[model samples]
Target: MTEEIKIQAQILTNEVCQFTVDRPILPKRSAFFSQKEDAKGSPLPEALFAIDNVVAVLISGSVVKVTKTNDEQWMPIAKQIGAAIRKQIQSGQPLVAEEDVRRSASEIDLRKKVETILNNEINPLIAQHGGVVSLIDVRGADLYLQLGGGCQGCGMADVTLRQGIEASIRRALPEVEEVLDVTDHAAGTNPFYSPTKK
Candidate 1:
């Protein structure tokens, strides 16, 4: 018989909960799924999204983060998520479809370079305003990003995206085609400078 999967569940923030499994779930490639469509090929991520209120999922090694609407409590949903993960694991199949997480050498190089700029340059400035910008994925020459913390719902998010975030990335990587924002600003709770409420 296959060993039962054990997962330690914890709340990361009002909107996010984490599940740490006993073994590596996505050993080779990490993934971030913000929409149900994004979970297509990944069985584990797809299972998590089936749970109501699950807005996002981040899979890195043994860690899986599930994000929900701020208004919903984790009390009811946590068990469902845990059950889904365990079920997928116990099914004795690959958690993620290889194609879903595979990256070309060129894509990998670009991703690392983009992350370096986000870490060394962009995030430092955004941090001052209680915000954070993260690269979600790299597809071909385009980048998918999500802004969190204060930048999530800030009135100046667009200005920051166009003038600051995109500008910096474009300057450092002219080959990068599109820098898209996939953040759910409506779910943001404590935007530092929300000129108008979300």
Candidate 2:
């Protein structure tokens, strides 16, 4: 068998950790465990494991990260999970369903709507502060945006994006699922409102 897959696990913080694999697991054929339930009378935490000993599994981009209950040891379970992932990948199963992707992609006409909103609403408001909002791309219902000028490095940018920009876009286009700002807030060299005195 070709060693096309590899798994590595590392503890990030006491509460947060990460496990990464070299190859993509879960082919389209394999079943997706999406049902989330917990025992009655007890309110379950977000990371609580409903499937046997395994807790929560999240697939973001190319990585499959898992979080387990506080009592569980990751070392022993890591190997088992890695083996299962490898088996699923080698079997040629699809990681995510095509129907879901199609459904998500169909929800919103991202480019046109985003451009319209930016042109009409966001730009006019930001222009007052010498800032600009640029639409990067739209994948499914998620929009990628970049903030420049006065808005880029401002400490209040997060607040503006969440409360102002996101709210306005969502109001204009209800089909939009999320607006993500992909700007590198730390590297803003020409922010419109710089603190340094001349």
Candidate 3:
């Protein structure tokens, strides 16, 4: 008797649900698809995005982390997500396109993408707190960021860094396992990568 692939689902947050399977959905590097447009060549993401309310999909190893709009209940949608993943696995196609397989985490490319994420997604949200984030460097798959302005030495700096900034980065760039904050806030500090200047 062939053991069927079983998916275990856990609701992580209001907008996020994490699913796991016994087999590797993505044996290689993890991938994050921001929207349906980004899922062009990735069949797994394409299928996952087809389910309504799935705003983002992250496939890391045997885990699938999906983010949906808060309007819908996860009970029904979780079933759909599991079904979609099962279909994809049963189909036996590459989760991502051959050309899209992640490379050796290029420093130049990682820097550019991380910078774009900060400029577009992260900084704007944190700016409400009068804070700014800049990339210090990329050492392998690790990121060093300098928190400035209000975030330099705020009481909630750690919360913002780990929960907000790091979560966003790790979600987008699965290869980034560590996001190190190297800001010394005692005095006003210089930014490593200034969004204004770039």
**Backbone clashes, each candidate:** 0, 6, 0
Pairs with backbone N, CA or C atoms under 3 Å apart (clashes), candidate 1:
none
What is residue 110's positional error in candidate 3, in angstroms? 6.3
Q: What tens-digit string does per-residue lDDT give for candidate 1 at 56-102?
A: 88777899888898898898899999889889988889887777666
- Give a tens-digit lDDT track for model 2, residues 98-151: 543343344334666788889998899988987888876565678888998889
What's the lDDT for candidate 1?
Answer: 0.85
Q: Model 3: runs farther than 4 Å from truth? A: 1-3, 103-198
For lDDT, the strongest prediction is 1
lDDT accuracy of residue 192 in candidate 2: 65
RMSD (Å) of each candidate, 1 decimal: 4.7, 11.1, 10.9
Q: How well does candidate 3 match the true structure in TM-score terms?
A: 0.55
What candidate 2 gets wrong by more than 4 Å, as runs, is 1-108, 194-198
Answer with 2 or 3, whichever has the higher lDDT: 3
State TM-scores per candidate. 0.70, 0.44, 0.55
Of 1 and 3, the candidate ahead on TM-score is 1
Off by over 4 Å in 1: 103-120, 123-140, 144-159, 181-198
Candidates arranged by lDDT, highest first: 1, 3, 2
Among these predictions, the greatest TM-score belongs to: 1
Winner on TM-score (2 vs 3):
3
For model 2, what is the alpha-carbon lDDT of residue 176? 82
